[model samples]
Target: MEALYATTTGLLAACGVYLTLRGRTFPVVVGLTLLSYSVNLFLFSMGGLAMHGNPAVVGAGTPAADPLPQALVLTAIVIGFAMTAFVVILAMRARGDLGSDHVNGNRLDVSREDGK
Candidate 1:
């Protein structure tokens, strides 16, 4: 299970990086999201994948999963969502202002047509 989890996280991070290197805004945004997801998963896994474990508040004999990672992951998820939204909005604004979605520059046709 640990090996599988590690492999999955690595794959996600690799794919995210590959996509992030593309010359477009959308792919970069998606890549960032994927990378964030992989990080979240890794952080969550650090809390241990206990089977049939009780809550941390339980006082019984059996071990309980660590709650810190879960809480951190939850906070990360919310922050990631907000960050993604802000970045996407910024990208759209840039696209609208620049008349193109390309990260580097607008296409010749678009530039010529827009008289930019």
Candidate 2:
């Protein structure tokens, strides 16, 4: 279970970074969101996977997962939401101002060079 989470989290982060570098606003925004999810998953995994139980409660002979990681994950989730919202709004504003959705500045100027 732990290995699964680690692999999943790593894949998310890798994909997010790749998408973020693409030459488009939508992909960049999506990548940002994916990255946030990856971060949350990574933090959550640190608390360990439980079977429909709270990490704060320890069972007989079994120690409960660390509470600090759980707390950190919660905080990260909230912050991630805010960050995603901000990035989305910024993308929208950029698209509106530039009148072009493409990330390449040269693409925007091509029309001027062609006199069209």
**What Cα-based lDDT does every candidate model obtain?**
0.89, 0.81
- Among all windows of 10 consecutive residues in model 2, the one with the lowest summed lDDT is 54-63
The residue-level lDDT of candidate 2 at 114 comes to 59
lDDT of 2: 0.81
- Candidate 2 runs further than 4 Å off: 48-54, 57-62, 104-106, 109-116
Tens-place lDDT per residue, model 1, 30-110, is 999999999999999998887788888756766789999999999999999999999999889989888888887568855
Q: Among these predicted structures, which one has the highest lDDT?
A: 1
State in Å the error of residue 108, model 2: 3.6
Angstrom error at residue 96, model 2: 0.6
**Candidate 2 clashing pairs, residues 3+ apart or interchain:** none
Per residue, candidate 2 scores C-alpha lDDT tens digits across 1-116 of 77887899999999999999987789989998899899888887765577666446646455565788888988998888998899888888877887765666445564665599
Candidate 2 has what TM-score? Answer: 0.77
**Once model 2 is optimally superposed onto the true structure by TM-score, how far is the C-alpha of residue 90 displaced, in angstroms?**
1.0
Q: What's each prediction's TM-score?
A: 0.85, 0.77
